[model samples]
Target: MIYRADPARYDAMQYRHSGKSGLKLPVISLGLWQNFGGTRDYPSAMEILGHAFDAGVTHFDLANNYGPPPGSAEELFGQVLARDFRPYRDELIVSTKAGYYMWPGPYGEFGSRKYLTASLDQSLKRMGLDYVDIFYSHRYDPNTPLEETMSALAQAVRSGKALYVGISSYPEQETREAHRILAEMGIGTTIHQPSYSILNRWIEDDKTIDACGELGIGVIAFSPLAQGVLSGKYNQGMAEGTRGADPRGSLRASHIEPRVLAAVDKLGAIARSRGQSMVQLALSWVLRRKEMTSALVGVRTLEQLKDNLGVLNNLELTADEIAAIDEASRDGLMELHPRPSGWLR
Candidate 1:
């Protein structure tokens, strides 16, 4: 079935400028990290994406290794663009990353000029895009010199293959260095994708988000629902058919320890008191940060996507509610969770 977007969906969405850049992102964005893989059933992906655009999600996030087999997510997303959104291409903000394991050999991953350039080309081919709206270095590579990585991103923009470049899961110090080098090369660094949620706050503690405004980089917070740990669905008990059972889902049994469950219970009550579901409350908390430009979320179904978009209806997180969340997490509630690749320095 061909997909279509609902034009009247913007009545409830509020947009924010990405860092200091002129581009604006809706409060919620879609991440193709899970369900949009080529190995998965294509109909499900088209359903969620169609619902997303109809619900006012303009941005789509992708990475080189987002699927069971690497690069399939981009390939699947390309099919989605062709099947459903060809005419609306000018209004979409599609992004893909390339720093993780892609092709397997030495140059297949990391921050070398050869790896990045080849990765972008491969991503473009999979995405069926002449140039991506944004391209990202999926993670930092200490082994490769920073100059070589920055040059690769510069080359992407110079070659008109990527309109903007970004870094993901990088430390505050590395973020500053990359921003500086990209600026010197005259390549624009538009945004940084990082994991941030009520249960995860390392980016806030390290001040990487605050520094983005100073460095011309916007912030996209991924996993804002903390792998569903912050939602009412998990507040009762291990919900059947939840992400916990998914093979690629990152939530470990240790993450569902007694204390974390207790925390979710308390937080869930607070969300109920405000007449919103725990998922909505948790998502709103991430957007509570003025520095965060968008919340990039993953979903297995269209229902989850719509529930997440409902967060746009209430961006009003009161000061007292903020304090309540802090109080609930006071027992070092999931403090300083590492930024994917390794612990933050």
Candidate 2:
């Protein structure tokens, strides 16, 4: 069977401008950071991709090292692209990143010209793409000169491997410098990807959002559900087959402290009061900032994707409602990272 996208797909989701750029990302973008790898069934991943597109998710975010065995996600996405998205390619905004430990040897990772350049080539090959809409450096590299990193990103565009360039998990100051460097090279930073959710407000606490807005760089939030803490699936406890059960997963069982669980329950009550599910409320809360271009979510099932898409219907957040949510989630907040750790690694 073939996948034909819904004709009315664009009518349901809200698309927002990516800062000063002409690009408009869906309010909620799908991320293939978890699952969708070689270990996961390809048919299920393809079905989720088709359902997401039908529901108006135009952006599919990926990275070079997003699999249990790194690089498998891109390979899986490539297969799906050839099968289902070949005809609708023009309507999608696909992105991939580099910067983490992708392969053996020093040249396999980070912001070095050798690594990023070679990485993008491999990524393009893996995704079967001539060019990714946006290619991100993935993280800041203190060891590599900012010039080298920014220039590699510039080369990606100049060489036509990536249309735009971005950085993820870069500190506010580093982001500002990267923006400056890229601007000097005649390629302004297109967007800044950060981890932001009700339970994880590092971007807010560190004023990264304010910094990006000031610099005219779009901000797309990842982990908006705080690694499933905001999904309400753990309100009762860590259900079997949850990310918490997977030791290799980003979400740890220890991350769900009693206080955080209490906050989650409170937030769930708030969601019910607003006539939405905890997932919808969590996503909508992240999009409350006008500066936020999109909220990136990882869904293992078609049902979760549909539930997240419901946030598009109600992006409104009253000041009082926001205040209430802030209070409810205050205790749920994770402390700021001393340095870019997990994802940045």
lDDT of 2 by residue, 1-345 (tens): 888899999888899988888889999999998877878887899889988999899999999999867999999999988988999999999999999898889899878999999999999999999999999989888888999999999999999989988999888888889999999999978899988888887777778788899988999998889888898887777677788877767776546988889899999989999999999999989998989999999988888888998887788989998999999988777764427443632
The clash count for each model shown is 0, 0
Q: For residues 1-345, write the lDDT of model 1, one tens digit per residue.
A: 556678786777778888777888888999988667766777878888887888778899987787756788888888888888898899899998888777757888878999999888888888899999889888889888988898898999999998888988888888999999988998777899888888888898888887887886889998888777887566567666676766556676755677887888888888889888888999889988778899988888788888898887787888999999898866526654444464211
Against the true structure, what is every candidate's RMSD? Answer: 2.2, 1.2
Candidate 1 stretches with Cα past 4 Å from truth are 335-340, 343-345
Which residue runs of candidate 2 sit more than 4 Å off their true CA positions?
338-345
Worst ten-residue run, lDDT, model 2?
Answer: 336-345
Question: Candidate 1, residue 255: CA error in Å?
Answer: 1.8
